[model samples]
Target: MEDPVNAMLCHHGFHPSMLAWCSMHQLNLGIMQDFSGSAILLLVRISFFGNYNAEDHLRESMKECTRRFKDFCKLHSFECSQCWLTTGMLHDNQTGWPSLKLKAYNARIFLMFVRAALQAAKSAREAQGLEEDAELSYAVMAAKALCSWFALVERAGRYLTPEQAAEQETAGLVFLRCYTFLARLAASQSIRRWHVITKFHGFRHILQSARLTLYNSRFLHTYVDEDFVGVWIRLSRRVAHALFEFRVLCRFLLRLQAMRTVDQRSVPARWS
Candidate 1:
């Protein structure tokens, strides 16, 4: 009899069906199963929220999921095995499955950022009901979270091997998603904050990171399914363009404000 876990591994990296199978069987398949299951559940929850206009209850559930996943990562921090007996033929004792481990770690990091983004968004939204000072406090919290996540991504490169870093599909998707989130956050702030232009530099950093990830993943077009690759490319390009345009608008607004300030000062001097 074939091991069910190995069967699922052969099918494709990790799929909903694989998670379902493990859930149905009540299997204790260790860290791989746990991490894959949590990641898939997070994806499912994200899909359920659709565009992240989530209801309060849905947001709470997302927070709960994030907490669970974080705890799981802490507990399993030292557990980095390439394969298990349950993986059967999929277990290559030769190459040692370093790529798989890297993918899993990357997924975990992606989830962490997503969780933080959600929390920040929620805090900003709730700030609308608070005092003026409270609102600024919440906005500052959101900005800090966004900056921290961007820095985390920069530091994450040290964790990857050259080959794992080159596997664009895995880490690349995470980068694209994070960049999109940051762009959206910037757009929201620009609507209310006149001084938001100061934050444009952070968006620029995310855009460059997204571009680098997409560039490295260009080879994915030939190897991956054409339709899937096309969709990824389109979404990435759309986000990149949106961020670029917003940054330009910010600079333009700042320049106009500076010019107006100089004109007002000169008018007062002429009157004097």
Candidate 2:
């Protein structure tokens, strides 16, 4: 290695393998792409003599699933109410990844994705004269793999049993193989938006990180920091620019103190 390169900070100078990734982000990206990627869309397209469209069938099924979950969320909003789920599960591919990740945190989301895929496959089977629908089968398999991975994620935040660690490794491997096949299918079909990228490789690293600890610990992701940034963005937009940084700090601190005061259990202070 050259001296100049060695002198750089650890993060900027490190090998690709040395860099860590956000597990939550990677999982959500892959899951989101599976349902909405052009490859999957092409695979879901039905070419039949009649008016039945498999893609439309799948879409409606997903919407129905989302509606059911939305109803459940109304009664228990704190546990599962996410903006994307409340509106509809089909988020725009352009700028909706954050909202998609928030939806992914809700476990009922798996039912919608997997249910729609399975229903589409079943419809293809019931179509009278069609041969084996390999593409639909591929979508079904990928969706199920995603469902399996999501279930694994929902098991526990930290300190998994040895059995659970083994399951995580197996789920990661199956998820990779399913998506690699879909990428190859995309190649054969000349689909434009479904090529594999390095970000997907982080899932294995996530599996490693998930099993690395020996005991209970806080979650690896810094969601609180993300929440703080979101709050600041809203605050900055609404406030005047003068003393911007100081105002933000003071207001943030005040908000925190007020929250604590409102929630505290001590008797209210009285002035005699």
Candidate 3:
């Protein structure tokens, strides 16, 4: 990908990858202006709410951050920003899926990437069990994403009525099952159950494509002009390895959830 950060460093006469990671670091002044303007507008709309102001500010800032990310993608021609936005919206269902669904192609593609990254992260985590591989960063980020995942699912569920959620229990279970399977797979075990997720037919393909795209984006050459091939390759491998480790950790979380269910059933002392 030409390491855009490195390119910027060369322009600034600084060492490779040494620049600060400010939101404005890679953007042109125009993008920054647009971001700040939108941010102020968003904040202004919510200024009356004292306590909720911080939450609104956080939401607005995240949207602005996404906008800045979009600008970066446009400049770099990577189109990765779309995937990020979709995934972000999915992780923050409060954003409402309507806007994202309007760009369904992009949303689907983004989900593919998320699934792939999640799969790889789960795999690595299972394999290494958090010993900190070179790819620990990828796994760590994926785990972080899951922290968001719970919030997203809870919010998304709110959009549906109780009956709907009950009816869709199978669907939710399917998603969780696939998540578990991937986690277990990362731990070097064969996946024994696929019926839940496989019923949709193309879902697995979507996941595979996402994984391949992620793998290529991280590991393969993005340009013929760059000479840091060896270093980039090493970086990509580390990302993949870390992602695997993270996924396994997520599996542990699922197990913990299951344990909680058992414990709740066993303990009755609080009320008594």
Candidate 4:
């Protein structure tokens, strides 16, 4: 079975079609019986399929799948309320269900982030001749999405024992990638809003939190490749440079203000 699956994946060039087929097969076989488990698998399929192809059609498909999955979960909750054994109870008997749920939640949040990013890019393009407020609104939306993602990651961390989580290098790498993504987004936003003092503070906070996430997962260095580490290093440098420039600007402003005050003090009394 593994050979056939691998062969099919290779034959299909690891395309969305292969993922769709596997998803449908799982559904038909009742392998993913629980709504939450099924939803998680669906999210994974969509993520894997859409990752390499970021077309509008792919985005729309992902959105539709997510909407349907959410509806399914809602309906499942209502049905479970009438049943003796709830989905929560069922999951309690399954040792790895919590981890699966967390991964699904992360995937859902990432989908939201992708949608927000697309919206922001579209707004930026359309706002070329529009008011700055329009662009700012999109920026705020993106920032809120990032905040939600960070919160979800924190929440997911609480689901597992610290020792068990530390052993999950793959999951740690996922978290690292997410942190890097958030850091890059914040750095870009900071560069655009350099004059906004509050944004620089936010950027610093994002960088610090990302660094902490990576530091906690530093043990993953042996598992990941050099390129992965290099990417983190490059992103860190970019963020650091942005922070450095922001600080320099602040100092320049302070110096200019001081010089203006000195010039005012040195001026002769008003010609009365």
Residue lDDT tens for model 3, 1-272: 55344345456456632322221111111111222222222222333112235556645544554564465446646554243332233221442211122132233223333334334544655676656432223323433343343233334321333443333343333444444443454345432211122222332332233233221111121222143455444445555465765755565456446645322223234323
In Å, residue 119's CA in model 1 sits off its true spot by 18
In candidate 4, position 264 carries an lDDT of 27
RMSD of each: 24.3, 9.7, 25.1, 25.9
Q: Which 10 residues in a row give candidate 1 its minimum summed lDDT?
A: 20-29
How does candidate 4 fare on TM-score? 0.19
The number of the candidate with the highest lDDT is 2
- Number of the predicted model whose TM-score against the real structure is largest: 2
For candidate 3, the lDDT comes to: 0.34
Q: What is the lDDT of every predicted structure here?
A: 0.37, 0.54, 0.34, 0.36
Residue-level lDDT of model 4, residues 238-268, one tens digit each, is 5446577676556555644664532222222
* lDDT of each residue in 97-137, candidate 2, tens digit only: 21222443553454444445455655767676667666556
Candidates by lDDT, descending order: 2, 1, 4, 3
Give lDDT for model 1. 0.37
Worst 10 residues of 3 by lDDT: 23-32
Better of 3 and 4 by TM-score: 3
Q: Give the Cα-based TM-score of candidate 1 against the true structure.
A: 0.19
Clashes in model 2: which pairs? none
- Which portions of model 2 show Cα errors greater than 4 Å? 1-20, 47-111, 123-129, 214-218, 232-272
